[model samples]
Every structure is written in structure tokens, then in C-alpha cells.
Target: MEINHKIKDQITGFIAANSLVLIVMAITKYFLPPFGGGNVIIFSEFVILPFLMGIVSAWCWRKINISTRKQSAWTIYNTVIAIVLSFLVLKEGMICLVIVSPLLFAFILLGTYAGKAMFKRNNQTLNASVFVMLFGIFIADSLSVHRYENKVADTITVNAPPTEVWKYVVAYKRIEKKSDFWLFRMGMPSPVQSTAEGYYLGAKRKCIFSNGYVFDEKIVTYDENKDLTFDITNQPRDPEIMGHIDILRGQFLLKDNGNGTTRLTGNSWYRLYVFPVWYYDIWAESVTRNVHLRVMEHIKELAEAK
Candidate 1:
């Protein structure tokens, strides 16, 4: 079996160059340790970025010189995509691995061709290629998850002072409603009232979703004019159900935006989710935010109207 030696050399050289930088970054991360004052520094970010760039740069060079550059370009593109995808999956951790695998495979053909071309009989090259392949995939997924971890932030601005709106907004039994913007067509209404086990922490609250999907939430944290967050324990382990695709961390936060407006942020923090990582989240978040934003706007309008 004959391989295009020149193209093969380019791929190997690219890997060598990137790997050297990655090793240096890793060592630097180990010594410098991105840790101080409660924040865990993401050492991997510093490492994978250079490698991703190197792969892209190699693709550019190959695009001009190598006849199989088209394949190489796709390979590099997929590698970059893999990095982005890995970050997303890594954040989800448990369930997201199921998703990240297929994405990494998209580049498998090109990657293998390049790798095999580079290493004819060297066992070390084969091992190194495998190591880098796995490492790159993992780094990409980790970064994806990290990026998504803090993506959704919902804010609430109440017209009145905190003392006034805090009572109603933080109340356990208050009936919620949609703001005008959330009126998709305006016929049926969302289930606003749910029975509360208790108004404070460690107590359970029964929340009913739009289509009879039931969720049980424990009040994890409750504070006045600061934050109210709940730990949702979804009822029944049925994945086939469409109404409640995920029962994530449901939370409410209140902050002073200066002046008289009280900012309230409601969020449905993601926990466990399955593959096609982008689609479900995009769909679910749209509804969650659409509904919540409308509700918050109504609160604002109502508060201001008075």
C-alpha cells in the first residue's frame, strides 16, 4: 500500500507542532494552576485552543499543496467541530457522551487516512495518533459543556421596590401568568397554580407543566430579595413522554439593579439530557425562556401599571 508521502509528512508535522505546544500548555497549567479565590481555572482551554488552530493551519497549507486537500479540509473542519461539540457534551458529562461520539466519528475517515498515511510501520506513531485523537475529542467536549454551563441567564425587572414585589414574586402559592409577548396564539393558558408542601426550604412543591406533566421540586434555597432556587425531582422515569422532556434545576434569582427596579432572573438550569445536544436544548430553552420572560414582563407591566 502506497501513501502520499508528502501529504503524510505534512499531517505528521502538523500533529508534532500542535502536540509540542499542547504539552507545554499542559505543563504550564500544572505549574500555574488556574486556581485562586474559589474559581477553578480551566487549564484545558489553554491547551486545546492551540491544537485546534494548528489543525486549521495545517488544513490551509494542505488545501494548496495536497491533491487530497479537499478531504483534509473536511477533516480539519470536523476536528474543529468536534472540539466545539466536545465542550458542550463535557459540560453535560454523563448523558452527553452518547452525543459527542457520533460527531467525532464524522472526521474518522479523513483522520484515519491522514494518520495511516503519516505512520507507515511505526507503532509509536499509531499510538500517538490514537492518543491525540482521543485527547482532542475529550478536550472539545469539555470546552463545549463549559461554554454552555453559564449560557442562559434570565433577568427580571420589577417596577416597584424590592420590598413591594418581593412578597408576591417570592410567594410560594402565587398564580403565575404569561406576559403579552408569550401569547403564541392566545387560546389555552399555562398551568399557573401548583400546591406547595411548605413555603420554605426542604419542602416539596408540586409544579404542573403545560400538558399535564408533573414535576416535584424541593426548595433548596429560599431567601428574601436575593434568590430562590429549587431542586426538581421529576416524577416517573418515562423518556417517551413529550410534555416534560427534561426536569432540570428550576431557579429564581432577585437582584437590585439600582434605582427602584428590582431585577428577577428565572432559569431552568440543565442537568441530565440525551443526544443531538443542540436541538433539544434550543427547543426547550426557547419555551422555558419564552414562557418565563413573558411571565416576568407581565410582572413588570403589572407593577408599573399600579
Candidate 2:
């Protein structure tokens, strides 16, 4: 009877601890200022969120008198629950969330251990000091300079010639198979259609997104059968989704493989003005690479079809 009662207590503590973590995240994301901004990701989502989860887990373990063997279960439970809540409830992008998942889990573990230490010592001064240190770091991170440009290039050798490839390069049809890559399933925008006006320099082309986001590019350098380079003039204006990123420019270079084939190299350069560029870069790099590959593969399919 005593064993069963202890198990029940442990389960209850787990639920309550994770619930508190979810609620805190909700408050930080929704009820806070700068809604849908990078600040939310940096200060609230990454740092404080994990810290709270850690603290809660530690508190629960100590309170419930859970066995050492069962203690690790609480950490895993907390992380999985938080991820689900972030996706379904918070409406965060799956790719970024998953990219940062390891970091968040680490934070939970650190916080849990910290929580254990705090409870063991039961010293208010120690608690106060640690809180101050974390707050200072968060403040510093907010004011820190974190602007960077991430460039991603993907190459595919197409069996068709440059002329055939160039036709598909400037513009192509919608990507019918949305499930070709994991990024597409994770909400990364798939290339719908690219349409260019005129064939000379200064021509404008627009690559449309499935969600109505359009990347407007102006041709700066146009080599008939070699390279097509364009500078981004207009970007998607969706504040809730596309506001954090600014796509700068994109280029497609066609190189002769000398074997009746062409090597298509796609390049994109974008600046992320958000703070803590390193953390966000993980998501940005993955997203850009996937986005590039999807388009390149789509072009390859169309070029090879002819």
C-alpha cells in the first residue's frame, strides 16, 4: 500500500511540474510584449523556459521522494510535453523547435540539478545570487550584438544541357510532391512557382510561397546561359511568421560538366537581424538548405523530363 501511494504521488508531481512549465511558456509567448519576435525565442523560449523546467523537475523529484531509477523519467516527460505544447498550443515552427530541442533539454537537466542543489542547501541567499546571475546574462544577451548572414548553396548535376536547364531555372511549375523532404512536412515553405517578366537585366521575378509569401527579386546580372543573379527587393510581410527573416538575394549558376550535362549551383544570402545569431542560425541554416534543395531538385526533375 505504501509503495502504491508513493507511485501515485510521483505521478501527480510530474503532471503538476510540467503543467507549470507549459503555463509559464504560454505567458511568455502570448501575454508578453513583442509578440512573435526573436526576443521571445532568446530570453523566454530558450533561457527562462528551460530554467523553469529544470527547477520544476528538481522540486518535484525532491518532494515526491522518487527513486533514483525513476528520476530520469521525469526529465524526458517534461521535454516531450513541452515540445508538444509548443507545437500544438504555442504554434511554433516545428523545424526550429526540433533544432533547439537538444539545447532546451540540456537546460531542463541543468535547472533540475540546480533545483536539487537549492532545495538541499535551503539557502535564500544562494537562490537570490543565482537568480541575479541568470538575469544578468539574459539582460546581456538582449543587448548583445547578434547580426549575421547565413549562406547556403546546393548543387545538382542535371543530365540536360544549360539551355534546357535555364528554362527551368528562371521559372518552374509548383512542387507537387510536398512530402519529398522532412522540411516540407515541418512547415518549411515549398516552392510554388517562379515567374519572371522580360529576359533582360533589371527584370523582376517572384518566387511565391504556399502561404502567400512572395520573394520579389530584381535581376542585377543576367548571363544568358551561365548565371542568373537577382537581388531581393521585396519580402513577405507576414509579421507572425516571416517577419524575423529577410531574404537578401539568390543566384543560380549553370556550369557545363563537359559530358552533355550541366551542374546547377543554387546560392542564397540572407541576414538575420535577430539577437543570438548562433542559436537562430541552426534553424536558419537548416531551413535555407532545405528550401534550396527543394527548388534545385524540382528544377532537376523538370530539366531531366525534357
Candidate 3:
């Protein structure tokens, strides 16, 4: 009977702790005015919140005087549960979940141990200092109001000549090469077809994606088979979730390899209006690289087909 009661208490406590985390996340993500809107992947959401979560969980465990092994188990369990809940209930996109969850978990775990140690030492001065640090980060992020344009380029050598590759780059007709990559499979959206009105400098190019997202580009530079640059006039947003990224400009450059092949380089520049430009740039770079690679590879396949 005593063992049964202990088991019941453990299950109840775990559920209660996880529920608290869920409520906090939901409040931060949904209820808060500015925190959860538009750019939800800011420093407060990713870094500070996870650290707070870790501290709370660790403090609870320490208070109860649980074994070290059990504390570790609880930390891992809470992090997993929070991520799963975010996906299932909060309806967060897979890109954010996969890319940012690891960092979140790491911060949470680190905070947990740090909190435990601080509590054990009863270090009120250190606790006050940590709170001040977090507040300072918030203030700095809020005050630094500047946008940055980040660029990412991917180059690949195609088997076909420059002329042939240029044709495909301008307006690709239905990429049958489906991306089975995990990102696309998880609904990141793959390119479908691209069509253009004219081949001149002022022409407009429209590229469609699987998820109904379309990018409308106006030709800025058209250097025959050498270079094609366009500035994005408009882009579609996901109907379900608000995307924090905006593509500003894109370019496709071609160089004639001495042989029968051509070197194709795809470049994109995007503006980051989100906070903490430095940290967000890392994720932005990664996402843009993936986007460039997928399109570049598809173009390579089509150019070589002939």
C-alpha cells in the first residue's frame, strides 16, 4: 500500500510540474501582447524562458530532496514533454521545433543545475545578479532597433553548359524531383514551378511552392547567360502559421567552365526585422542555405537532363 501511494504521488507530481510549464509557455506564446506574435523565436522565448524553466524545475527537485538520478530524469522528461506539447497543442512549426528545441533543452538543463547549486549555497547576491543579467538582455534587445540584410549563396557545377542552365534557371517547369528530405517532408514546402513574363530587365518572375507560397520577383539585372538578379516584390505567407522570414532579393549566376559544364551559384539576401540580430542570423543563414540548395540541386538535375 505504501509503495502504491508513493507511485501515485510521483505520477501526480510529474503531471503537475509539466502542466505548469505548459501554462507558462502558452501564456508567453499566446496571451502576452508582443512576445508570442510575429517573431515568436526571439531571445526571450528561446533563451530566457528555457533558463527559467530549468531553474523552476531544478528548484522543485531540490526542495523535495530527490536523488540526483531522479532529478536528471525529470529534467529530460519535462523538456521532451514541453516540446511535444508545443507541437501537438500549441501548433508550432516543425522548423522551429527541430532547430531550436535542442538549444532550449540544453539551456533548461544547464539552468536546472545552476539553480540547484545557487539555492543550496543560498546565494541571494548571485540570484539578484542573474535576474539583473536577464533584465539587461531584455532591455538591450528591446532598445537595439536595427534591421540587417543577410546573404547566403550556394554554388554547384552542372554538367550542362551555361546557356542550357540559364534557361532552366529563368523559368523551371514542374520540378518532378520531389524532395524526400526531412525538412520538406515535414512540410517546409518545396518549389513547384516558376514562370516569367519577359526575359528583359523589368520582367516579373513568379515561383510557386507546394504549400501555396508564391514569390513574385522583379528582374533587376539580366546579363544574358551570365547573371540574373531579381528583387522580391511580394511573397506568400503560410495560412496556418505566421512566418518570421521575408526574402528580399535573389540571384542566379552562371559561369562557363572551360569544359562542357557550367558553374551555377544561387544567392539570396533577406532582411531580419526580428530582435537579437546576431542569434537570429544563425538560424536565418541555415534556413536560407537549405532553401538555396534545394532549388540549386533541382536546377542542376533539369539542366543535365538534356
Best candidate, TM-score? 3
**Over the stretch 1-306, how does candidate 3's per-residue lDDT look in tens digits?**
866765555555446556766776666556765542445445665666677777766655554566767767766776777778878887767676776567767777777778788888888899888868976875555344445678899899999999889888888888777676676777777678888998889999998888778889899999999999999998886633255678889999999997999999999998765545666678778767877787888888898998
**What are the lDDT scores of the predictions, listed in order?**
0.51, 0.75, 0.75
lDDT of 2 by residue, 73-117 (tens): 667777777788778776666665676677777777778778888
TM-score of each model, paired residue for residue? 0.43, 0.77, 0.81
**lDDT for residue 145 in candidate 1, whole number 0-100:** 35
Q: In candidate 1, what are the lDDT values of residues 218-274, reduced to their tens digit?
A: 888878667778777765443332222445677777777789878778877753232
Please give the lDDT score for candidate 2. Answer: 0.75
In model 2, the clashing pairs are 54-112
Residue 158, candidate 2: C-alpha displacement in angstroms: 2.2
Better model by TM-score: candidate 1 vs candidate 3: 3
